[model samples]
Target: MRLSTNQVFNSHVSSYNKGYAELSKTHQQLTTGVRIQTPADDPVGSARLLQLEQQANLLGQYKANMTDATNSLTQEESILKSMINVAQRARDLAGHAGNGAYNDHNRQAIAAELKQIENELFGLMNSKNASGEYWFSGSQSGIQPYVRNADGTYSYQGDHSQQYLQVATGTQISISDNGFDAFESAKNVSRTETRLDTAGPNGQRLYLSQGTVATQRDFDGGFRAGAPYRLEISGDAATGNISYEVYDKNNVLVPAQDGGVGSYDPTLENPKISFLGVEFTLDAMLKDGESESDYATLLDGHSFEIGMAPDRFATVGSSASAQITDSTVVDADAYAAGFPAGGVTLTYDGAAYQAFAQPGNAPIPSTFDGVSNTLTVAGVEFSFSGAPVAGDQFSISADSQENQNILNTIAQLRQALEQPADGIEGGNLRIREAIATALGNIDSGMMQIESTQAHIGARLNSIDTLTLENESLSVYNASTQSLIRDTDIAEATSRLVLQQTKLEAAQAAFMRVSQLSLFDRM
Candidate 1:
């Protein structure tokens, strides 16, 4: 088709402009080494490159997390070793206290040392890692695990939540032990006194059984002498110097105040009875079987025995010869296991008990079902043997594993040598064993930490390897993208030179063509 003059000129101009534009773009790429300067340059290549950059950033973050986990685990392991040392020290102190040759003064000095140990242990329990996190407070990384009260007894501030280290893929390791399981709760016993009026004018007397003088109680709801307590009993001087008694916790008689009678009086000078309603076992008493009621002849038979409260667990005696059956009575652990949710309705057979909790419905029951018979309470766990009854009640208060059994023999020997009574023979064997168990736990914890370290190290190593491989892959991918979308510097330079020559020729031709009017030619 024949074209108009304007159309022909515009077409030639478009061709030259297209050639110059391509040449300009090539020159710019040669000036800048990078293939893609912005998204507009090559949309697909730029997106892929951005993705590679994000992956690199993510790899860096993973490395940082690995470092934090490793450091925290290391701190936990160090603390466990320190705890092992403390257990050995405690065994030594117990041995010193047990020495028969030691008098009260000497014992007091030993006790002071024991006190120091307690404080140190408290400090250890409250130990903070480099991150200002608590050592044994479980998941409560910010709070101290134990608090000292004015009453010399320590209160546990930590629960059973075990903190864990996230060192690897799908693997978590416990870094802390609950403090409650480490220390034993002491049993508190006390006494109170009140006048016993003869039951219904029948001259009622408390029934006494043989070898029962050590029973502790609060008489007529008079007063309780348990933990963090003091004894204060009031009496009338009129009842002809009323007879009373005193005792201690655990049904053991306090030697200083045995068969205690008040030495104070309401009106009578120095006529005070310090011991009123003292807990005593119903030992042998003058017998009348059953009695008759006559004020004159009624007081004649005068058979009496001490009454006991149900709350006060009774043991026959502390004598090792008293048979192991009575052992459960003073054993706080046994009571804790056997007692109900409110209080233990101990078996009359006097056998040790294992309390359990009832299964809840659906998910709750499934948690402890036979197929999945694991009870995980903050990582502290126990398995139930049989299905729980409706009223089944597991103990919330139970002796925790102290892990002292892992102590080295050499450390134990040192303790035995320094304080002879702490050795593992004869009556003191139990105490020694307890300390050993704690040490054993330390060993176990250390092994766990070391194992975790290995895992974390492996994971970190993997991260590094994978991250490096990914980096290499990213480089290769980038090179391929550059090939598809990048300008060739050598080819671009050659085109730029050729385009400049053509552009100058086109300019001359255009100038010549514009001057080609008929008048100009004439």
Candidate 2:
């Protein structure tokens, strides 16, 4: 076949160019230590390498997330530890302040220290991270978690959205918790109050150690819960005498013995003034040189108010005994259980009497047996030895629990300290109540803090596990990428030499072939 010199020359040039290109590529692979410099080098292997590199980058990001999450969790854990210590210290202080011997001045000093602790705790709850974001503010890291109100109380300002960080594919970890659950919104016990009317005599107040005040009475003459009662004492100057009557919140008269008129005995010692369902001893009676006439004048128009007390709790079992005229045994517990929510009235009508749970519930009847002197009604047994008065009556009622919290407990302690147990005007009672409330609140706060700490620990452990998984995945991805895209040094060097030799041979052949042309021979 006849070939043109131009075509022959073009063929030799093409061969040399191809050989030089291969040699350059091998040289590049050897120098850079990468098997493929571009997609054109090895399309399938290059594409696989790209995928492996992306996987490795994602693993690196997961590791970074683990680091960030761990940092946040560590900060939160440290803050919580400090909070627990603070709560414990507060509890210890409350225990010390509760001592009855501590006078008002001493209590005030304790309160000052507690105020500092409260402020400290508030600061801790509103702590920020290295990034200047709140640690307990949930998703609203920019917002403060707790705010102090003008009334000296605290309110949670943050929402309950837990902040999270993605530590892995399909795995997210909580980086923060809200303040409401950790501090402000902890569960507290219930609290109630038994207060006196402001309009009544200032110093002529009454306190009961065992019995709860009935708050309500049914229209059918039965007891009702949440009923407010007051003992009204009225006096006539002409008679030089005073009488007591019990009235409900609505001023309705409550029945008592012999037309509900309190049997007012003027005897100074063992003077029993009985009315409604309760009896009070004149333990701290009138001041020195005070006569019955003087007593009547002093309490002329005043009333003794009674309601729920803070320390009292609602219960299924409570007992009360009346001053029996004879050898009478009363089963107060069984009788009280069958009574209404507030209380009930047991009236003796000479031989037999009736008991009412509520106005419309039912009337339980009891007949006095002179032989056994026993009367049974509603699982209750009342045994009397002598003949009982026809007008005698008894009152029994239920109770409720008080709701409690840390702040209120602290406030109550401060109040108690301000009014130390002086030997006058119920100072002892106030101090005692203050100490009890403070101790309870401190315990509650500690419990809540511990619970939150437990959650923080679990989250930290999760971060650790995720971090390990991320590191392991990163190593595997790197190894796989190396196998797919890394240069085999020995193989690349061998290919480099072979390509160079071929390129030199092609040049040599082209020189000889060009010389063989007829023009060259001539």
Candidate 3:
């Protein structure tokens, strides 16, 4: 409280320093466009700014993810579109080749074009992304999706699991689809069929029909359903001592129902070999050698596979037609002899169902289950259309999954076209069937490719939506951050002028007070 000149001068000096500091801070805020140059300038605002910056960074990252995902999806869609085009071309070729008038040379030429299309499709399926990773490889993007094996068949090496990118909060989008689902698993309609691959005794081979030899009933049986199994039948035709051996897909011998080597009883009316819910009767005819031992020896190592045969349905009647609806076997021999007007009845004797023909009952009325698309008569599934009063008849034959892929379809067509017309008993008929099946598979492949492309398009849409959302969020974050930490230029300029005036006044007062001190006046 003492009115000393020295004290007054020192107080003025302190006030001037404070005013100068305030002016400098205001100038810094106006020049830099930020209210808080350091945390001490505005601790709470600085904390808020830090939070807003973190949020903005997160949103930016989300936007980046969306961009990457969009790129991948777009690439996938383009590749799939190309593949669809290739498939469509192949389908057209198949359609042209299927014409009955086309000669073997014509078919072979078409097949050559189809082969090229197949290779192109294979390339598309193994397409790479911007990062050079396979687009359809699923989670294994680094590995190629498909590889050609030594046998000329393509194998899908990619896993089924899909990979996703986090494009938004709690949102993920798949960027790729598994090649298997896109290329291999596309089926328009699932039909049961068997294909025969007989080894040894060329002349003894049953002019094996071009349809399913076995149907898939229960996939959860002891034996694997999708995979192939070998059925080896060997024994003396004279003594009828034929025994059958069964092997699984891995070549491991599969035990019979009794867990022993499956035995075939010759005494049974139909000498059938049944395993894993599939049953097919052996041909009762003897070989050319004609000896019991020779028949047995020649039949040695004669093996055929039993598996889920597909695309092997045949309708035999011009009017009332029959198609296979279930996995049950239709004895081609029996159905042909007694079908249409023959009146076949299914006899279920508590344990199992059997097909029996009522001799007098011609044009038998089949019990049709429309829901399952099945008609049961004597343990065979015949899907019939239109009402058969008494004499209407039709029949379908065996089928399998062989030649299901585009490559295999083309291969079968080429083989059929290249083979001599008079080679086999039904050579022309078999070639016709092969061409028809190839065309059907190509159509199905086209459908699958289209579906996959549609899926990719949807993903691209989602990514665009996410990207817009991220941009909006980023803008919001920037505005909030500015509100918390950016300077108001008008307010800062006003404060700077005021602070400059205060500092000038304080300095003038300090100078006057210092002059008034006793030592200065002396």
Give the candidate number with the greatest lDDT.
Answer: 3
Off by over 4 Å in 3: 1-9, 188-190, 194-405, 517-522
TM-score of candidate 2 on Cα atoms, chains taken together: 0.60
lDDT of 1 at 490: 79
lDDT, model 3, position 177 = 90
**Candidate 1 residue lDDT tens string, 1-522:** 975678768977897798687667767777875557669888887787677666656545545555565566566556655765765676556555545565445645655665566566557657887778776677776878765432223445566687765433364545455554433221112221223323323343232211111222433232234211122222233452323334334444433343343322223211222233333222111234542222222222323322322232111112222111211134345444534332211111122223233221111111222364433322223343443333333323222221222222222333333444432222233223323332333334344434534544565565556556546665775666567557777777787798888888887887777566657667
lDDT by residue (tens digit), candidate 3, 1-522: 668766776777687777778888898898889888999988888888888888887788888888888777777787777877777777777678667677767777876786777678777878887678887787999999776642344556677888898888899898789877777675522233344566546444322222222333343355345357666766665775667777777887776552326665534443455555444445433445564445454555466666544323333333333322334546645544545443344432222323444454334444556565456653456553333334434333332343244555555556566666543455555665565556666777777778888888888887877788888888888888888888999888888888888787777766775776566668
Q: lDDT of all the models against the reference? A: 0.43, 0.62, 0.62
Candidate 1 regions exceeding 4 Å error are: 1-17, 84-111, 129-396, 400-512, 519-522
Query: Model 1 compared with the native: what TM-score?
Result: 0.44
lDDT of 2 by residue, 200-307 (tens): 243553332222212212211432332466656666667767677767678778776423356454444334443333333322235567655566565566655654
